[model samples]
Target: MDTHFIAFVLRALAVRLHTNRDFLSWYEHTKPDFILCTNFLGGSVIASIAKRANLKVPIFVYAADVFNNPKAGYCSKIDRLFIPTELGVKNLLSQGYTKEQVRLSPFPLQPSIQQMEKLSKSEARKLLGLEDCFTLLLNLGGEGIGSTALVKQLIKNKLAWQVVVVGNLSEASKQRFHALAKQLPGMSMHTPGFVSNIGHFMLACDVQAGKAGANALMESLSLGRPFLINELLHAARNTQTFFLEYQVGWVIRQPKQQMITLKAFAEDKTRQQRIEYNLKALPLQFDSDQFVNLLLNEVKSLAD
Candidate 1:
């Protein structure tokens, strides 16, 4: 939020803003120590404005995704860049940015649940109306793809497990899933679209199925849930590396192949147990305090 950023700035140092007619008046009356923009406009636009104003204040561009695809050309005009992960730093370096210009930071999570203790599986499942027996939760980011067909096939095979889809789904897609849910009596299917308490859902279920968005993947790992990631996204390589490093979960290129293996795994209780054990053994690697401190320090350095 703007207010949150403003509060952070005020705590660190003096902050001021001038706009519209007041811009000229403020520029004439006072000189700024630094200028910071939260990527509100394009980097080139910010650079041009600074040039036209004859301001020498350093401009720091806080980028969340710029490093992921540096060819997007948003980092050229900024004095420095702040990225969320070491992976991001590597990406920037590969794109020709010097090491000194890039700072590693952590992505900020909502304060409400960052440090909150995780709930027990049974307690979490009970709250979400999920069965504690055998269930797989698929979180395909915002766009739920290949999961409906996979769930239907799993039910057709008479697997004694429930499938819960926990992302955005169209009404038609939901209706189709509901119909399949009726056909498969032993396999109850629930598509509760977009719940804020997704952490509880992640904890309640045995597995996650989706593309590797950093937010969802981190949450799944934090809750010790094995994930089945789609390997089509640009972040797939990074996700694969993380999973391999941590021994967290499996990755599949084709959804059809994943479904075939999932069907087999669903029927094999021993295999599922083994997978869960491995997931539990994986250590937590995300550190928010380090992330925030790094970002603040970088911003301060740019100001200096």
Candidate 2:
């Protein structure tokens, strides 16, 4: 695993892969039917190896996030490519893949979201211990990085809304939030770090303030809740495109812009209803069983 040793080995393997029999003798003994690669760079290298072997073995590449591949046709080097978003499909096409090679599939959601118990807003609010006041859910997807600033801003300003900040990772972050909560006597806020029952909170809040990550996007769309995206970067940019295409949510750019947007959504019931309607109109969702079946069938065919 030394960097110099790895570079030297790759060079030696490239020069004498077949002649240097011991370098990769494991492949001959193992004779894997196909190689599936989840890692971005490793998959491309593995595919190249299969190509050099005259493709006796096939390659199946799963794109981890939307537009995550760095190289052109990196996933296309494989026999089959599974991309999770329609935007991802376009990215592959731009990278020079044929229509036959790529398949758009749903990103697998958690069991909770798949078997999500549909709750009326009142019921969901009761479960989250939220009052009937305007409610906002602060979830920055699985990473739990952003939203501390927004949390303090709302509480310090004493915004008349119930704010539930879920899924923060570290204890330090949680403490900072709790400490801020104590400073404001009348402000309504809740901080719960990383819960499996995020599905409940998703249904409970009026607006989901977060980044454009897949889980948050899918859950918001599934629950027919408007997602007020807090940032768009890297893979999140692809999510922004999807939201724009469907009019599912507002992509926040400036800090002041989000506050203005939130105020409008808070004050206007009709606009809130409109945003939720757009999110529901989209066909995006997570059917984990069906997604798993697709992968299984592909694997079975290769194995046969």
Candidate 3:
């Protein structure tokens, strides 16, 4: 009766039945010392394939989400499991992994994002030609799911706050936002659909709103911007605690409610300063080089 259980069973059956001759052939041809994988499904498949190949290759899996399933015994096949948060490490430990079997690593931001120039609030606003007023960044992942509702609330309430919405919005959604932009002439509504320089946009805003996805959360914190999370996936469920515990942000839903909080937050400069300071204090962001070196050192140690 449980949907998750049924889905898990179907996936397990598929994993058992799945076979890729090309993958196996390629593995045999290349014969790497070890394998590093990003997701559980791929890691499990690679582990099964490696065992079938009769190779003593090590497999490392960096869990993209906090794996709450303690019964996921397939993870034992992984030589090392890397988790990004202390809460994740706790979850895996409770999942029966040994101390040596798990490694705690910060989620590494993309090189472009990490290396981007850190701009002051005034400098960032100037670069984007944003008004020196309360600004909010609404980026609900690539699909831009919750953005329209929030923007409508802002328009209906006649709020003059600046909004920067960045996502791969549908054409219809773009037209809708364009029309709405005309209604709120005082507000600076920037709907730069699907931008590459998201870090710059983030720096220009006082707060970010979206799903508590791994990348979005890390990117916001890396830029020292507080995140107003509305949705959470299974993997991101633990992130709520991180936000609450650190006084960095709040988890609120409903466009009207979010607007109310946004208005209040905008007026409270001391609170904004506190949240920004807290965001900067968290040890969440890492560079690409550090991530690569960490993996390389681990592989060398295993080889030795």
Number of the top TM-score candidate: 3
Question: 1 or 2, which is superior by TM-score?
Answer: 2
Model 1 misplaced stretches (Cα beyond 4 Å): 1-67, 143-147, 235-237, 244-246, 263-290
How many backbone clashes are present in model 2? 1
lDDT of 1 by residue, 138-254 (tens): 785677655566675666666657778877777887788788878767777788977777888887887788777767876776677878875546534566665566556768866
Please say which candidate is ahead in TM-score: 2 or 3. 3
Q: Give the CA lDDT, 0 to 100, for residue 261 in model 1.
A: 76
Candidate whose lDDT is highest:
3
Candidate 1: lDDT of 287?
Answer: 59
User: Model 1, 287: alpha-carbon shift in Å?
Assistant: 4.9
Please give, for residues 1-304, the per-residue lDDT of candidate 2 as tens digits. Answer: 4233453355445435554344247677788766767655556566655566564776777776654444532534567777777778887777666877677876677788779789988898898777766778888556778756676566656665777788756777777767777767766767786888988988888888877675676667778888887777565566667767877778886766787778877889788777777876666546778777777777777668
lDDT, residue 190, candidate 3: 77
Alpha carbon deviation, residue 88, candidate 2 (Å): 2.4
> Across residues 1-304, which tens digit of lDDT does each residue of candidate 3 receive?
3233543453455336645456677777998888988876676667656666666888898887642322343445668887777777888787667898888876778877888899987788899888877888889577767657787888888887888877888777777777887888797777787888888888888889998777787777778888888876655677778777888877877778988888788888897788878877875646667777778888988889
Q: Estimate every model's Cα lDDT from 0 to 1.
A: 0.64, 0.70, 0.75
> lDDT at 138 for candidate 3?
85
- Provide TM-scores for the models: 0.72, 0.79, 0.89
